[model samples]
Target: MQKMPQWADVVLIPLISLILAALLSALVILAIGENPWAALKLMVEGSLGSTYAWGYTLYYTTNFIFTGLAVAIAIHARLFNIGGEGQAMLGGLGVALIALFIPWPHWSLALLGGAVGAALFGAAWALIPAWLQAKRGSHIVITTIMFNFIAAALLNYLLIGALKPSGSMEPATGRFPEATHLPTFQDMFSTAETALFRGAPVNVSFFVALLACVAVWALIWRTRLGYEIRAFGQSESAAKYAGISPTRIIVVTMLMSGGLAGMMAINNVMGEAERLVLNAVEGAGFIGIAVALMGRSHPFGVLLAALLFGFLYQGGAELALWTSIPRELIVVIQALVILFTGALDNMVRMPLEAMFLRLRPAPKPARKTEPAE
Candidate 1:
C-alpha cells in the first residue's frame, strides 16, 4: 500500500542525502585548492584514527544524544522546544549547586545528585513556557526562544554576583569537590593494563546517554501516556473528543524535553569540565533541532544522527587545525547536510517515489477462465 518501501524511506533516503552532502563538501574542498580525497582522509584519520579520537567523538556524541532526544520527544507532542539552550543553562546551575553544596562521599552518589538537580532545574525552567502555551494560547516556539535569552542573562547576573568564587576573575564557579569527579574512559580502561581513551573527555555519561535512548524509545512506543501524546499530536480535536487533556500533555511533554536537555550538563559540567562555566552548552541545543528533524523523531534515528554530528564536530576541528580550509566552511558543510535532510527532503523523496512506482509490475488483466467458469 505504500508508494515507497519502508527501508527506502528510513534508511536509503538518509544515506543518499548524506552522500550528496559529502560530494558537495568534497567539491567545496577542491574549490579551496585542497585535495578533497586528502581532506576526507584527514577527517577519518583524526576522528577515527585512535582510541584518543574516539574518546572525544564519543564525548561530543554523548551531549548530542541527550539534546537530540530532548528535541525528538517534544516533536512527538508537536511542540518545538527551542528553549533547550536556556533549560540546559539552568540545569548547569542546578548541577553546580548540588556538586558544590552536597558532600557526596563518591562520584557515583554525586552523579545521582547531579542528574536529579539537572532534571529538576531543567523541568522548572520549561514550566513557565508550558503554562503560557497551554493556558494562555501563547506560541511555544516564541515563548521558549525568549526564555533562552532570559536564562542567559539570569545566569550571567548570578555568576557575577553570587556564584563566582572569591579572587577568581572568571564568571564560572569554583571547581567541584574531588569526590564529584566522574570516571573518564581512560580511567576505566587503564586498570586493565591496556591504555584506551587516554586523555579524552569521554566518560561514563556516554553510557547514560545510551540508556536514555533506550528509555525514550520505551516511553514513546510502549506507554499509555505516549499513546495519548501521539494522539494529541496527530489531532488535537480528535484527542479532545477522546477526553485527553491538551494542557496536561503539553505541560508533561515539555517537562520531559527540558529534563533531557538539562541532563547534558551532567556530561559537560560534572563529567568533563569539573566546573560550571559559561556557554557550557556550546550550541548543542540548536543542533538538536536538526538531529531530531533528520532522525524522523525516532530514538534510534536520533542516536545515529547524534553520532554523525559528533563526527562533524571532531573532524571539523581537525580540518581547521591541519588544513588551510577555513573553519567557516565546516559550518557550511553542516548547513548543507541539514538543508538536504530537513528542508529539501522532498527533493529526494519525490523522485524516489516516482521511481518505485515505475518499477512496480503492471496489473494483469482478468483471466479468460473466469468467463468459461
Candidate 2:
C-alpha cells in the first residue's frame, strides 16, 4: 500500500545515487585517458587500508557529523541556516579564548569549558538572525550568510591584533598550552609493538561527535519540543492554528542549530589544530548542507553520509598524490555526488518507487456479494 519502504528510502536511494555518480566519474576519468577501475582501487586502499588512513577519514567525518546535525535540526524546523560558517568561526574564537586564558589543570576540564564557550558564542552569533527572522520578518538565509562575512572579518582582525602572539608573523593564535592538548588516537591505541594512527590528528573529539549524533537523534525524535518542531515544519499555518508560536520555534531552533555547528570547533580547534587559525572552519559548514541533504536530515543517515564524504576527501587526496588525476577532478567528483544526491534526488526516487510498486503483490479480489451471513 505504501509507495516504497522506509529502508529503501533511507538506504537504497543513496546507494543508487553513489553508483550513478561513480559511473559518471569513471567516464570522466576515461576521457582523461586514465583507468577508472584502478583509480577506484587506489581510493579504497588509500582511505581504508590502515589505521593511519582511518584516523584522517574519521577526523573529517567528525567535523561533518557536527555540522550535518546543525543543518538537519534546522531543516526539521523548516529553517534554512546558512551561517554555520560564521557560527563555527565564533566557536573557534571561543575555544581560543578559553584555551589561552584559562589555565586548566587537565585537558578534560578545558574540554568542558571549551564546549560551553563554543556553544554560547555560536548561539550568540545566531541570535541576531534568529531575532530578525522571528520578529522583523527578515529571511534567515540572508541574515545568516551576512553574519558569516562579519565573523570572518572579526576573526581576521583579532588574529592580526589582540589574539596574535607577540612577534608571530602567522595569522593564527599561538600554540595552545600543554595542558590543553588532547590525546590523539595513537596515544589511546598504540602499544610497544605497534604504533596505530601514527602521525594522524584524530583525537577524543571523534567520540564527542558520536555522542552528538545520539543527542540530536534524541532531540529530533524522542522529545516534546521535537514534536513541536516537526509539526511546525510540516505546516506552519496549521501549527499556528494549533497554538505553536512561530517566533519561539524559529528562535529556539536556530539557537540549537547554531550551537551544534559551533561545537565542531571542539574537534578542529581543541583536538586537531591545537591553535585557532584563520579559516579554521575550512568550508565544513557548507559541506554540511550537502551532508544533511544527502542524509535526508536524519542523524543516523547523517553519520553514514559523513563517513562517505570523509572517504571521498581522504581518497581524493590520495589520488592527487599518487595519480595523474588533478585535485580539481576530485572536486568535480564530489560535486557530481552532491548534484545527484540533492538536486536530482527525485530522478532516482521516482524510479525506485515505481519499481517497488510493480514488485508489490496484487491485492486479493473481494468475495462475491452474498446474502447476509
Candidate 3:
C-alpha cells in the first residue's frame, strides 16, 4: 500500500472537525423548526456581506489579537494565566486615570502616557500571582483565578467612589479629554460620500495589533530569550540543567503576558468607550484563552483565530437582529471550536496511526516457521 501523507493528518483533521460541527449545528437548527440553510446563509451574510460588517469584524479582531497574544505568551511558558481579565481591567484603570488627570497639549504625549500607564498597571497585577507562584509555591492557576475577583472588587470601588462621573449613577469614570482620544481614519473622511463607512470606529490601534503580531513572531523565533522560554515550556528539569532559571523565566513570562494584555486597554479606553467603566474588560481576557488554543499558540495562527472570533462577535449581534436565534449561539460556537482544537492532537494522531498500522506489511510466514524450528 502507498504511504499516507503527513499533511493530511495536520490539516485535514481540523477541517473535518469544523465541517462536522457546522453540520451538527445545522441539524440543531432544523430540529428547532428553523431552516438550516437560511440560518447558515444569514450567519455568512451578517458576518461578511458588507464593508460595515467587515469594519466591525476588524475592530473586534484588534482586541482579540492583543488578549490572545497575552494568553499565548503565558501558555508558551507552560503557565495558565487566568488573571488576564484582571490585568486588562487594571490596565484600563491606569490609562483612564492618566488620560483624565494629566493635561497633555499633544496627542502623541497623551497616547504614550496611556499606553505606558496601562503596561505598568497590568505588570503589577500579574506580579502578585507570579510572586505567589514563585516564592510561595502556589499554583499559578489558582492564584491568578483568585486575583481576578480581587481586581473586580478594586475596580468597583474605584469606579463608584473615586472615578465616578459627577451626577452619574453608573459605575464609570469621566470621559477622557478629546486630546487624549485616539485618532481614526474616519475623522478625515467625515464629508465623504461613504460617510457612514468612513465614520466607522476603526482606528490606528489596528496597526498596533499588527505590529504586536510581528514582534511576538520575532521574539519567539529569533531571540535568545524566546529560546529560554520555549526550553522552560518543554521541560523544567532540562531547562534548569541548561542553566535557565525557572523562577525568573516564570516571572518574566507572566510580566510579558500581562503587558500584552494591557494593550487591550487601547481598544477599550481609546477606541470603543473613550473611558474606563466597570466590567469594561467584558470577558475578552477569558475568550482569549479559547483564541490561543484555537490558534495552537502560534502568532500568525492567533491572528487568524482572533479574526474568526471577531466575526462571530460583531456578526452574531447583527444576526440577532434578523433572526430569532440568540446571540449566545456565538458563544456556544466559540466553545465548540476550542473544544475541537484542544482534541486535535489526539484526533489527528490516533486515527492516522491506526490507518498506517493497518496498511503495514504483515510479518513473513518464513520468519514464523524459523522461530518454530
Candidate 4:
C-alpha cells in the first residue's frame, strides 16, 4: 500500500470527523424528540448573531487557548498532564492573594503581580507530580489525577476559612480592588438606548492568548528545547539514545505547560471574574484537553479548536433558555467530536494513501532485461 498524503490528512480528516459528528448528533436530537435543524440554528444565532454573544465567546475562547496550549506543550513531551485543573486552581489562588494583599498604586503593577503569582503557583502545582514521576518512577497520570482531588479539597478549605470575604456567607473571596480589576469593553459600546447590552465586560485576555499562541508556535517549531521534546514524544528510547534527558524534559515541559494553565487563572481572577469564586475556572482545564486533541496538539490549531468549543458553550447556554434540550447536550457534542475524529482518522488513511499513490509519478517500467542481461 502507498503512503498517505500528509496534506490529505490535514485537510480531510477533521472535515470528515465534524460531518460525522454532526450527523450523529442530529440522530441523537431526533431520538430525543427535538429538531436538529432548529437546535443548530439556535446555536449559530445565539453564539454569533449579536455583538454581546461574540464578546462572550471570545472571552471563553481566550481561556481555552491558554489551557489548551498548556496541554499541547506537555503532550509534545510525551506527557499527559491531566492536572491542568489543579494547576489552574492553584494559580487562581495565587492571583486572588495578590489582588487582596498587594497594595499596588498602579494597575500595571497589579497586572504584573497577578501574572507572576499565577505562574509561580501553577509551576509549583506541576512540580509535585513531576518530582514523583522523575524520582520515584510514578505514573504521572495517577499522580496528577490524585492531585486534582487534593487541589479541590485545599481550595474549598481556603475559600471557606482563609479567603472568604468578611460579611459574606458565600464560598468566595472579596471582590478585587478597583485597581486590580480588568478594564471592560462596556464603555466602548455605550449608547443612548440600551445600556445593558453596552455594558459587556470583555478584557485584554484575548490578546494575551493570541500572543501566547505565537510564543508557543515559536517554542515548538523554532527552538532546540521543543525539538527535544518532540523527539521524546515520538520515541523516548530514540530521544534517550540522542542524549536528550527524559527526566529534565519531562519536568520542564510540565512546568511550562502548567504555567500556561496558570495564565488562565489570570483570565479568570484578574480579567473576567476579578475575584476568587468557587469553581471559577468552570472545568476549563479539563475542556482544554479536548481542545488540544481536536487541534492535534498544535498551538494555532488549538486556538481554532478552542474557539469552536467557546461557540458551542455560549450557543448551548442560550439554547437552554428557550428549548427543552439540556445544556449538557453540548458536552455530548464535544465527546462525539473527539471520538469521531479518532475513528475517522483511521478510516481515512487508506483512501488518502490511494490518492497520494495516484498523484505520484508511476515508477519507470522495470527494465525487461533486469533478470540476466
Which parts of model 4 are misplaced by more than 4 Å?
Answer: 187-197, 342-344, 347-361, 364-373
Candidate 3 structure quality by residue, lDDT tens digits, 1-373: 5345555544665566566656666776677687878876776787677766666777788888988999999888899888889989988988898889999787778877877888888888999788788778999999888988999999999999989988999899888888886776466434646654354566778878889899998998789999999999999999999999999999998998888888889877777799888899878888788788777678887898899888878777876788787887777777677667665557755776678777767577768899787
Clashes of each: 0, 0, 0, 0
- Give per-residue CA lDDT, model 2, range 283-330, as digits (tens): 888878878888989999899988988888788889989999986776
* Residues 139-206, model 4: lDDT tens digits: 99899889888999999999999899788999999988988876555544556775533444457667
Q: TM-score each candidate.
A: 0.95, 0.94, 0.89, 0.91
Q: What's the lDDT of the predicted structure labeled candidate 2?
A: 0.90
Query: Which parts of model 1 are misplaced by more than 4 Å?
Result: 362-373
Better by lDDT, candidate 3 or 2: 2
RMSD of each: 1.8, 2.0, 4.1, 2.8
Deviation from native of the Cα of residue 37 in model 1, angstroms: 1.6
For residues 271-324, what per-residue lDDT tens digits would candidate 1 score against the true structure? 999888888888888778777877878999999999988888888889999999
lDDT of each: 0.90, 0.90, 0.81, 0.84
